[model samples]
Target: MRVLHIDTGLEWRGGQRQALTLHKGLLSHNIESLFLGNQAGELHQLCKNNHEEKYAGFAFNGELSLTTHHEIQNIVKEFKPTIIHCHDSHSAKLGSRFHKSCTIFHTRRVSYPIKFLSRYFKYKNIDAHVCVSEDIRNYMKQHFSNTFTIHSCVDIKRFDRVVNKTIFDKNGDINIVYVGAFSNQKGVDVLIKAFSNLAKKYNNIVLHLIGNGELLQPMKTLAKALEIDHNIVFYGARKDVEDFYLNSDYVVCPSVSGEGSSGVIKEGMAAGKIVITSDLTANKELIDDGINGVMFKTGDSNALTMSLTKVINKEIVIDHQKIKEKVSLFDCSNTIEQYITLYKKISNK
Candidate 1:
């Protein structure tokens, strides 16, 4: 069966990583797979670097772009793919426009609710709804059927590299790395407050903030205001997150909202580092209370501070073996197989 993957993103994030992984996996399985995405995106660059005509990258800004729509139409006409896999909301909307020609599968990465009319208009033509987390799947099932849970997986092989500690090297006696966009949804402010409180008790510990967003400056300002800027190192954005993950003692996914199967938790678990995340409904699927991961109240800085304190004091021990075993079940290999099975199941019909 032929598959056309649509992921028009401007950055290299978990969704783009998953799209690239699936595209490569499909090719490895001898499936005729093609990709279309933003011309400037890392995902498109990766595809282009392969020097394959099966991939197409455009200057896609949004679903309203006429050029992007025409390019997708031309690709559809030429590729004649049996399955059209949309990797984000914009791509889903654009892909849905061609529902009559091919089956549309949209993957939702967040668990945020879509209103009834908006949801229907968005998903009415979608043949399948692929959720990156079980929480997202359950939520989508309330609005539509044919929903599936496929965890946002990490390639364990990617973390198998030798960490040189050259970029984003570890700092302080205890290093806790936070890798994600700096935003209110990611709870960067709460993380800063919690880290400041944690700092009051420990001087040798450090909080490494990675990734950049509009809230980055604000978070930095907040850290300085809290008199903890010296302890908190803002690395902005780095491609060598795996090395940071490897060299750190813990990975913190301090998300207060908008999480569907955290990539930080998965990558951290794969690297054998202890993951401390907020106790969101989806995060609970990846973390258990005082088990594989440490969790705190969703938005409570005090709860997060206490959780980190417990982790620091060895009050809650993370079993490396247990984490490895649990995370292996959601490896990229399994994720690709699940998608292939779903594609075959729907394509055959």
Candidate 2:
């Protein structure tokens, strides 16, 4: 099947990663795929190696721009894809124009903000909605009455265990890793405070934060105020995430809002590293509390601290194989096939 994936986001966040994975999956399956987005962004660069044609980045706001309709129409006429699987709301609305001739599947990557009548008007043409988790699926169903739940697939082998674990390497100090943006929704401040508490209990503890955001300096300031500045290391938005996961002993996520089955959680699990995430629906789907990983109350520094202490003290017995097995269900190949199934189903209608 031929598919054209469209997204306007420029940041190299989870959404972009998922999109790239989908593109690659389609290619690996011998299905034609193309990506449309801001031409100058990372998505364009990432698509450089793929043997696929990328259309020019159009000047259109994701939420409100229909000005690029003529250009999109031209591209669709030229490519003639069987399905226009829009990866974001902007692409979905744009794809709505060609819905009569081709299947248009709107992949809802996040929980879109809806304010009364505005939402009522925003979803008039989307044929089907795809959500990453049950929580998000249920949420959309409650609001729109039409949505499908599919777990975000991951590469299981990419992060599987490479070597057997030795003794708790307590001599080099416990390494804590945070792999998300430095944003308010990430609850970075809560992590800083929790790290401070854990540091007081154990002198040889350090936190390595990966990724950057608007609140990077503010979170750094919070660490200093809590007197844990010396124990923190900011790697600032990295592409070599697997290397960091391999080196770290534990991974922590402190997001307080806007999460749907985080890719980071799956990555940490696939890499066989223990995880401590917030008590949110997205996180709960991955962590089985004292089994695969642990959970802490969202935005609660004390709970984060205690969870960290348990991980550091070897209180959580993380089964390496079991954690790795969970990632199998999310194989990108299966995810693409599911999309293909949906595409065929929708197109025939």
Candidate 3:
């Protein structure tokens, strides 16, 4: 069976990454797959390099542009895929134009509430809805039907062959890494504040903020203001994140919002590192507090500081093997099999 994947995200976020993973997995299984993304986006560039003929590009500026719709429609006519999988909001909107012609499957990766109008029409047009988290699926079930919950997965092999290298001075320092966007939703400021407090008591601890966003400068200034700038390393958007993940003592996700099945948590667990994340619904689904990973109160820096102290002092012990085994179930191979089953089911209908 053939599938066409559409993603219009400008940045290479979790959704875009999942789309790429799914596309690669499909090709490995000898399933025909095509990708369409923003021409200027990072995903498009990666797809162009890896799968030139299977990749298509268009310029998208958030809103549903007529030109993009026309281009996608023409491609759909030419490709005639069994399933049109929309990976982001913009692409879902674009895919809505051809719902009547083919099976449109939209993957919801966020936990935000859906508008009544959009749910009744645009989302309703979708043949099957795939949610990255059960929380998202529960939220969307009220307005949509034939929904499936498929957690966002990672290629476990990518973390298996990681070459360990120090990103910071390892002078018996307990290094912690955060691998996501430096934005408000990600709660980078919360992590910085927590680290600032932790640094006062434990001078040997270090925090590595390893992604770029609007709040990068602001978070740096906050670190300086808190007098813990020396304890924090702001690594702005590195392609080689596995090195950082491998060398770190722990991985933290302090997101206050917009997290639907965190890839960081799964990747950290797959790497056999202790992952501490916000105690949100999505996070709680993956972590069994103090077993595989730890959880802190969302947006609470003091709680985060306490959680860090527990790990640093050996007050909390994590089973590295158990964590790795738990995460193995969400590997890209399993995720691809689930999607292929769904694709075949929808195609038959």
Candidate 4:
């Protein structure tokens, strides 16, 4: 069966990555697939550089664009996909517009509760709601029917190759890495405060932050103000993420707000590194509190500082094998299989 994946994100975040990966995976399985997405972002460049033949960098304009509506109608008529998978909110709404042509599936990654009034009609055309985490599904179940959990997965093969990058020049410094957007939701501020407290007593400590957003400058200012600028390194959205993971002794995801799941936690654990995250319900599903990883009170810098201290002081240790084995359950290949099965199951009816 043919499938069309629509992702409207202008940035190459975890959701876009998953959509692209799934499209590629379906093509490899001899299933017809096409990715219709924003012409902007690293995703657009990657598609052009590698798989232009299967990509459509559609400029959907905006939510109320008549041009976008007309274009989508034409695409649905010509492509006639059995399934249309919307990867973000904007595309989800757009996909719903032509639900009569094909089954609609929306991947909900956001964790915020929906408005009570809009909940009923928001996902009206969606045949299924594919949530990235169980916690997300549980919350979404209250707002929509046919919600299912499918964790956004990592490609384990990504860690197989060496990046040959130096993260630290020091002999035995403990390198900690945080790979995510620098936003209040991601808790970059909390991480800075915690790392500052950690760095005060530990000279051999280093924190590597990758990814960029509006908060980049603010977090940098906070780091300097906290007197931990020397111990902090900002790599700002590196393609060689595995390189940082390879060099890091620990991975920290200090998200203050809830989300579906974290790519950082998945990739870090997939690389067999201990992940330290906030005690969000979704995070708890992955981290077993100092077993596979460590969890601290959400938005609490003191708690995070203590959590980091445990790792640096040798008070916390994890079996890398256990970490790899756990995250392997979420390998991208497995997620592909699950999606294929779901697509066939729904399309048959």
Whole-model Cα lDDT of every candidate shown, in order: 0.87, 0.77, 0.86, 0.86
The residue-by-residue lDDT of candidate 3 on 12-106, one tens digit each, is 88888899889878988999999888999998887778765577888775656777677877888899987889998777778877777778899
Error of 2 at 296 (Å): 1.2
Supply candidate 3's per-residue lDDT for 185: 86
Instruction: Pull out the clashing pairs in model 1.
Output: none
Tens digits of per-residue lDDT, candidate 2, 1-349, equal 6888777777767887788788777777788887777565666656664544544465555455555777778888988887887776667667877877777777776654656764556566677788898878877887776688777877766655554333122323688888898887888889888888888888678788888999999888888888888888887888777767777888888889988878888888877788889998878887888877889999999999888887777776778777766766777777878877877776677
Q: Looking at model 2, which ten-residue stretch has the lowest summed lDDT?
A: 163-172
In model 2, pairs of residues that clash are none
Cα lDDT of model 4 by residue, 1-349, tens digit = 9998898888888888899899989999999998898877678878888766689877768876888878877888889888999998888888887788789999988898866654656578899899999999999888777888888999999999865665554423778888999887999898889988888778778888899999999999999988888888888887788888877888999997866888889999977888999999888888888788889999999999998898878899877778978898899999999999989887787
Residue pairs with clashing backbones, model 4? 211-237
TM-score of 1: 0.95
Error of 2 at 41 (Å): 2.5
lDDT of 2 at 311: 72
Better of 1 and 3 by TM-score: 3
Query: Distance (Å) between predicted and true CA of 153, model 4?
Result: 0.3
Q: Model 3 — TM-score against the truth?
A: 0.96
